[model samples]
Target chain A: MSDPVISVAGIGKEYVLGVSMSGNMLREQIASGVRKIFQRVERPNRQQQRFWALKDVSFRVDQGEVVGVIGHNGAGKSTLLKVLSEITEPSTGEIRVRGRIASLLEVGTGFHPELSGRENIYLNGAILGMTRSEISRKFDEIVAFSGVERFLETPVKRFSSGMYVRLAFSVAAHLEPEILVIDEVLAVGDLEFQKRCLGKMGDVARSGRTVLFVSHNMTAIHDLCERSLLLNHGELVADGATGDVINGYLSGLNTDASIKRKVSNDADAWVTDVRLIYEGSESRQGFKMGQSLCVEISYETKKKVEHLGFGISIEDCIQSTRVFASVSSIHGIQLENVEGEGRARVCFPDLKLVPGRYMVTITLNAKSFQYDRLEGVRILDVLGQDELGTGWVLSRQRNGVVWLNHEWLLDGRQ
Target chain B: MSSAETTEMPERIIRPKTGLIGVNFRELWRFRELFFFLSWRDVLIRYKQTALGVLWVILQPLTSVVVFTVIFGKMANLDSHGTPYPLITLAALIPWQMFSNAVGASSLSLISSANLVTKIYFPRLIIPLSSTLGTLVDSLVGILLLFVFIFGYLFGREFGLIEVPVGVGLHWQLVLMPIFFAYALLAAIACGLWFSALNVQYRDVKYVIPFMLRIAMLVSPVGYLSSEIPENYRLLYSINPLVGVIDGFRWSVLGSEFQPYWPGFCLGATVVLFFLVTGVMFFRNTERKFADII
Candidate 1:
């Protein structure tokens, strides 16, 4: 087999917490100098602590392989990428690569506002590691792709934010490095422009180049990368196929206790547990398309309250777009008098979400006051062929976040 | 989508190194285009929307010359070494303005470009270097204005409208003017590197710079000629790097009694060299933390 294109061994990064001085350089310099002189007489302070941002991260990727990295915020995803791209030096370990690597940590990073769009194309392109000759060769293609040809000579400060992002992304896409490193900066522009960016990235992956992608969008990760790595609190928690890694991440989220709201007195109510039920059984949060799904929320009320309201909100996890929100009052259903520990279940006959994760939020209201609202209470994963598919298998062309129920008619023509 | 399209480039290994000097000149050479663009951007932004535009460049030193001529030439009666006091101050102000402006701009370059420093990766030295180069355009304009004034003086004499005790003419030493101008830029970069690196951590440098520049102007030969200094302290005063630069400017343009003093000039050159080397070393040492702390 061919040699791996990128290799990392025992990479670790440590950052000191709150020790670096921010204000008054001259005074800080004098204080540090004095501290150095009195080092033998004094002990280190409590604030001078070291926290590792990454710990013993080791991985290898062959040439032409695309890998996705998934993690929550402060999970060391950015730190790992920064270390690999040499933005910051690691506290320990080393990395070896076998190709010219170009990282797009941000779009429009070095663009000057006063410069014209045509000038910025060359300026930003060079900052992204493209030589002058290379930018000139691809100048026409980039301008056409951005579709801002009419305003090419205008200053970037005059362009709208959407136009600016489009031009920046276009220049970045034309960079022909052997290995490309990208962060979550693709979450810009309108949906159509984002689709084009995905298409361009797909083309780059197919053209025999290595790619390392990091994002919070799990659906994009699942569609683009076959292999995945999951990081948690500065450590590599899982490494396997994309499906299994995502499953591992979701299951890990379940271990943390349910978030409880603060109770001012015995009269307040709070949500205790949340679960997803499928097929009349205790399902572990995974459901199939077209199957009946229900969100069960358990809560307790210490004092009796009248006209208490219960509601559920479901949001598409990948897009972070709210898909459903309804309250008991909206349906004209009001409960009166005594309340105690009980469970509220909201049912959906057909789960229209196309194979991806959805986040369920539970809310409890008493009269006009909000008693408690638990966000991201449970992550619901939906699987199977889309409901609109013609057969048991779904094609990539028909992929979307939602599966709408509709029919098409055809007419015969001469 | 063809496998044969990949260009051949050298493979690089990245690892942590603990040392004072770890410059990657090859990597810097590859990013030369970025350096050019950064300076070009600075030049464009400086003159973008002002009503006077590039005229402000010439106006800055001319205004300073007028103030100095009134205060020092008429009020204080300082010596000008056989040259007209206006010409003396203008020549010295041209180079001095470039030096001071380059230093001021470069010292603040890292802070002003905080977005690029935090989000991107390139050699950190490029920031101060490009900012220093950005002030070169104004210096060129200032130099052209000096020539215009000199020609105006010549026409006034040819028409017999004015009389002066001293002879005014260009000399062979004028060819060496570029060498001295380059020294001014080098000294600016040298001092700028020190302050810019420190300014990232302690913002006091921002307030400290303009006050420091005011004091620096008084100590240098901007208001008077180097010949005015007592013979014993001439070498001591040249220890300030700008003294050699100002002295060289007057000697190159006006000639005569303002000949270049080799001993004092060498001492000033040595001081500039010392600042340049130490400033670069300090800057490189502190650069790795800028992205994290700034």
Candidate 2:
């Protein structure tokens, strides 16, 4: 390789939780020093909790390479990105970079609420390392991309949450650096704005700049990145082609077969457990586009509940949009004077959802009030497919939650 | 957007560093635009939505002068070396307010601007330095009101419409007033660098600052003259850096009627320079852990 654009060598970051409370104060620091003279302790910090967010990680990326970082919540993905972007210093090892770096971990890093949108655009741009002349040159383009031209003079405090996010994201999207580090910033804004943001990211990836992307959305990672790194806990566990790495991550998650969790213990009647039945078998990992999917729920009641109903909501985890929702009462099915233990199955014959991970929330409701509700109970993974007989496979960036049933005609007739 | 060869690009290595106590002048110079914007933002927000606005700058010292003129001049009958008590009190109060406002805000600046410090990487010194610079705008306005008050009162006396005592001499000494004001700013920044760096670690430093400034006000010659201090206690009083500032202002404005105490002023200057050199070194050494702790 012709000189990697970014190189890291055995980097490790350790954090001491609630550390040096005694050292923070002058009196406490002095007192601790006096005691240390008398007591011969091996370690002065025996009580402080030391957590290694990242340990002994080494990687290198060449010029124009786009690498994806995939891991679970505490897999050290963010810590690695932070060390690369210079937001925090690592406890051990070192990093070398040959190009200018700009990382976008959060949108609108230094936005002031009291300032007008026009003033904030400049301030936020400057905070992100843009010179004044550069901001002035792109000021018009930034405003137009945000679609908030009419309210540019108004304070951002009065903006709707959607408008605020769009304006903030617009300023960040225009930054052009030799190396870009992004961390899950696409999980925001409305569906239309999200589509535009994805389009902008495509333009960035095609421009041949080195990118290090960290995200939980597998589809986005698979579609954009050619190489991937998988982290488990604080160590680098896997690194190779994107498709193989994703398979390793998914299989790692499949080790746990139970797809049920107890949400709360407050209600008189509650759901005991839940599982997905696919293709006449109990499976949480076997799902695809255009297949019959069933959600089976088991419940117990303290007293007999009249006209009991079970509700289910399928929400898009990537886009955070609700795809489908229904209750047994709405479909004219109910159990009268339900008692003891029982099972209910809700099935969709032709599941038209696009290929992506989704969250399932189940609730138990009587005629008067809700007995118990379980939110984000289980994650349902649907594998990508080519149902349309073309080269287009499903991903979060290119598709919505559900595919429409419309057809296109060459003429006015179909 | 150019796809040039990567060989020419400047390379940087990031690692945990120790014993880097000296300031990097080139890095601070490179981020000068950020400094200007931060200081401008503070000045804009300080007077935002207030009715009096910049008027409050002039009004603050004027009201203090009235109270001291009556209490110290009319009741105690303290010596002013033939100059009017009100004129001398205004000169001293001007520097006192400037010192207090700059030091107080700049000391808490790093804690208040925690969002910027934790998110971005620049010279962390910019936050405290910008806040200290923002108060200079108010100082400029106060100096204008001082000149107008002196000239307007003398004009009325010239016309014989009002009876007032003349205490100011329009001489070459007046041109040196900016030097004293600049010296007062150095004192504030010197103390602010120490307190603000400490404030990031121990949050109780926030509560200790206001109480410390209150004690500072009593020790300096704000409402009283440094000349009136007893001979036995004079040495102890001269250790206060602001005693030199107030004395310099009174000398500059009141001319030969009041002379600056050179031995005490020289001692105070020496102490401030010592604090400044040590404070910069301490702040630079401790800044590496700021992001993790804050």
Candidate 3:
């Protein structure tokens, strides 16, 4: 294998919050001045403790490898990317990068609102270390790719959010840096633009350049990256193949099921907890995809609930797209009167979600009308044969999320 | 993956060091087109919507000369060292206004361009440096007004102002005008570096800078001649740094009636150089945090 294109060792970053207030105000200024004159330096008025944004993180990426970094929020994913981009310095550790790096950490990163798009393209290019002639050479191609030719002379401040993302992503993708780091910028663009960006990233990776991609979308990660790293709370938790790491993250999330409960200060009503039970056992823990599963929601009511119906919605976790939803009334199971404390269970004969994380939202409503409801409650991980592997899991590709068992007839001569 | 096998292979294409300072300078040079573009943009934008447009540049110093001539020349009966106070103040105003405007604008350059600093990697110094370059157009316009005043005084013969005898010996040392202007630019850059860095952390620095510049203008020898300063306090006055620059300008243009104050000027130049070097050091040290804080 070729030498690693990027090597990060023991990298950590510490930030001291509220340090800006130490000596600026009039009182602090005079106090500091008096202290300086007397040669009695006061202890640093450190009102805040040091917080580590990243700690002891180590990783290596081989040349031409496209690696995906996946983790939940506050997982040090952005911190690690910032360190690699050199936008922020690490308090301790070293990182050696082999070539020029261009990062699209967010859309419209270096764009000036007052400057026209044409001027900003050049300014953005210069900031990425491109010479004037280089930007001029690629100018038309970038404009065409961005689809902003008509508004080229307009200031970017007036551009729509979609237009801004398109132009920004276009500049970043066309820069041709040896190492390209992209954050979740594709999440903002339209579906077609996102597909184009993904295609461009794939093209960049195929041209023997290193790509470090960060996104919460499992589909994108699975489709693009051959290897992946998982970070949790500033620590390197998992590092391996993309599929395994994503599965590990999902399963790890399942064991710590904090998504079941709801607490609120409003006095009206709230949900207590949600659990899935199957075959006389708590089913929230694990369930293979296409298996029969039952979800139970426990709730508390301030007053009394009459003519109440329950609604269960299963949504694809990654994209927040709802796959299927069924209300108790819609399913012809009605509870005319519900009082103080109760539990409702909705059972699916065959759970047919593809291998992915799914969120179940429980809604309570009055009969023949709408009422107070909890939108999203418990989350479930559905494991497929490909996810569970052949050794320990049954092969059930016969039926999936969609049950389309129709046969098509065609003439052979055509 | 054996170490021996890897060692046997040729060394990877390691990028050259590109010394930190050299790389920074080269980056600035490569971005020279942007610098010119931004400065030109500033110039065009400044005058675009104005009714008088570039005439304001000439009007600024001309009006200031008229005001100073009334207050100091007529009302106070102050000594101008035999030259017209209008000429003296106008010559001094050119450099003084340039220095003030450059320092004032450049001080906020970084904060105003926070979006650029946070998103891109370029020498942070370029923002302030380009701002100073933008003020040069205003300075040139002020200088043109000064020449017009000089010609008016020569031919119009207003207010007992007469053209000097033609054969007066010219000082060869006056060729140091560019050197003095360089010192002024350095002083502005030094102050700009200090303020821009502070502004990134404390945003209150933005408010404090204009007040400081206003007070500094009243104290500097811009509207009044340096000769009017009491001998005992002249040295303290020269410590302001622009004293030397204004003195050098009047000496270079208005000729020998205005002698360069060497002792205080030299001390002021030294102070300017010290501030510049230290400013560069402070700016370099704080620059790494700009993206994060900004």
Candidate 4:
């Protein structure tokens, strides 16, 4: 194998905390300078603290490797990309990069709102390190891909945000830089454009170009990257094949389930506890298809709220797809009066969900006002069941997400 | 677009380095297209909707000359070295307008493009440099108008429509106009680099620029000639740098009796060089923090 295109060793980035305050910075600096001169010795303020955005982050990407960086907010994913892009210097260690690099920190960077779409194509192309002739070479393709040909001469300020993102991404994707560093810019634009972006990214990866992609969207990461890295609190916790890393991240989330909030707004109602309980057991695990499953919610209301009802929404954790939603009010089963502390339980006699991890969101509300809402408050892991009597697990690979009760009759007359 | 052998491409090490040796020339050269586009964007946006698009460029210096001619020439009767006051003042206003507008916009360049700085990975110097170039176009227009006035005054005096008592003629020193203009731009860039870097960290620098320019206008030889200063303090006064530009500018275009004072011009040039070297050093030192802080 050839030498790695990008190599980073012991890279650390440190930021001084709480230095930015909303005021005239010159006056503050002048006052500080004067104080230092008078004192003859400057000391760091007590309120100041040191934050390490990245610590000992070591990685190497061989030529033409597509790697996905997955992490939650404040997990140093952005700092890592910034360090690689050389937008900011690392406080410690070294990074060696080969070939031309184009980094897309956002869509439509360096685009002037007053300039027309045709003009912005050239401007944004140049900002991404594309030469003038190179932009003209791909000009027609970019316009066609963006689907903004009708408004090509109109100023970008007049274009819808979706059109703006489409044009920007089209120009960026046409760039032929050897190495591409992209942040979560795909989060913008419509679903169709997002699909096109993914397709284009896949083509770039297939063309033997190195790519460093950072995103919170797990499905995209799984689709485009064969290798993945997991970051937690500025540390590289895992690096392996995409499946293992995603599994490591998802199961890691299971331990932090049952999120509770102390919302003081109105204080009408708030959830205190939320969990999925297996039938006849306090264990929170071992949920199975076609098994009795119960979702228990403990909440409190400072004042009596009429028509109080509990709602639950189930979402597919991996794809973030909403699977089902049901509310007591919609079922015409609202409580006449609810006050103080109480426990509410919703039981499914035969849970029809296929085997997968699902996220549950609970909401407490009345007729007109929403008291509180908590999303992803709990995780339900459903195990596959053999409800079809096929001697094998009833899995989504065969039966889809839910099981249906149906009878099958076969007549053998031959 | 050439599919050349990859062996020809140079590898870069992105280690943190200190001091003046840290500039990446190859990277800057590769992004030259961006530099041009950014400058072009600024120039195009400035006059997009104005009814008299490029005319505003000439209009600014012309109106300023009229105002200075009325107040400084008619009311105050400030000395103009025996040349037409309008000719001499307009000659200096070309470079002065260029310097003021360039420095004004360049200093605020980084602050205004905070989005680009924090989000992208191009050289931060491009912002100020492109803005300076954008304003250079305006200065060129001002220069064109200065010549029109000089010839107009010559013809108008012959026709008895002008009352100025001095001859308006070009001199051999006009060959040095490019040198003088270069100095003006150098001075602007020097201050621009310093103030643009400072503006990122201290936003009050933006407010300080206009106030500082007003004071600068009074102290520099914008409306009046450097000869009016007492002989003893001429060297001290010429240290302002714009004094040398104005002095050399009038001498070059108006064919005035005032010659280029070598000592003051040299002193001013040295001061401008000092600002250039120090401004670049300081800007490079603080640029890495711009993305984080901004």
Most accurate candidate by DockQ: 2
Question: What's the distance in Å from true for residue B156, model 1?
Answer: 3.0
Better of 1 and 2 by lDDT: 1
Q: What is residue A229's positional error in candidate 4, in angstroms?
A: 1.4
* lDDT tens per residue, model 2, A1-414: 367888888899998875473346766767778978987865746547688999999989988888999976678998888888777889998899988788888787778777789988988887777788888999999999999999998888899989999999999889887888988888789879977987888788888988899887776888789999999878998989999998887666443556444535446688887788887766665588888889988888877777689999987654455778999999888789988888899987778888877778888888878887766566788888788889789776677678878887779654
**Residue B231 displacement (Å), model 2:** 2.5
- Global local distance difference test of model 4: 0.84
lDDT (tens digit, per residue) of candidate 1 on A1-414: 755778888899998875463454677678878977988776756646678999999999888989999876678998988888778888888898877778889999889888889999988987788888999999999999999999999999999999999999999999888888899878899989998999998998887889999987787788888899999889998988999998888777554545444454334677777778887766567788888998777777877767677888877766656788988888887567747787778889988777767788878887787778777678887876545465654432366666778766676672
- Provide TM-scores for the models: 0.82, 0.80, 0.75, 0.83
TM for candidate 3 is 0.75
* Candidate fnat values, all: 0.67, 0.54, 0.20, 0.69
Q: Model 3, range A271-328, lDDT digits (tens) per residue?
A: 6667777665655545776677988777666666556677888766565457898888
Candidate 1 chain B — worst ten consecutive residues by lDDT sum? Answer: B1-10
Could you tell which candidate, 1 or 3, scores higher by TM-score? 1
- Highest TM-score model number: 4
Clashing pairs in 1: none
Question: Each model's C-alpha lDDT?
Answer: 0.83, 0.83, 0.75, 0.84
lDDT of 3 by residue, B180-263 (tens): 777788888889888888787777788898899889888888777788888998888899898998888878876777776889
* lDDT per residue (tens digit) for residues A122-173 in model 4: 9999888888999999999999999999999999999999999999999999
DockQ order of candidates, top first: 2, 1, 4, 3
Least accurate stretch of 10 residues (summed lDDT) in model 3 chain A? A394-403
Q: Is the docking of candidate 2 incorrect, acceptable, medium or high quality?
A: medium
In order of lDDT, best first, we have 4, 1, 2, 3
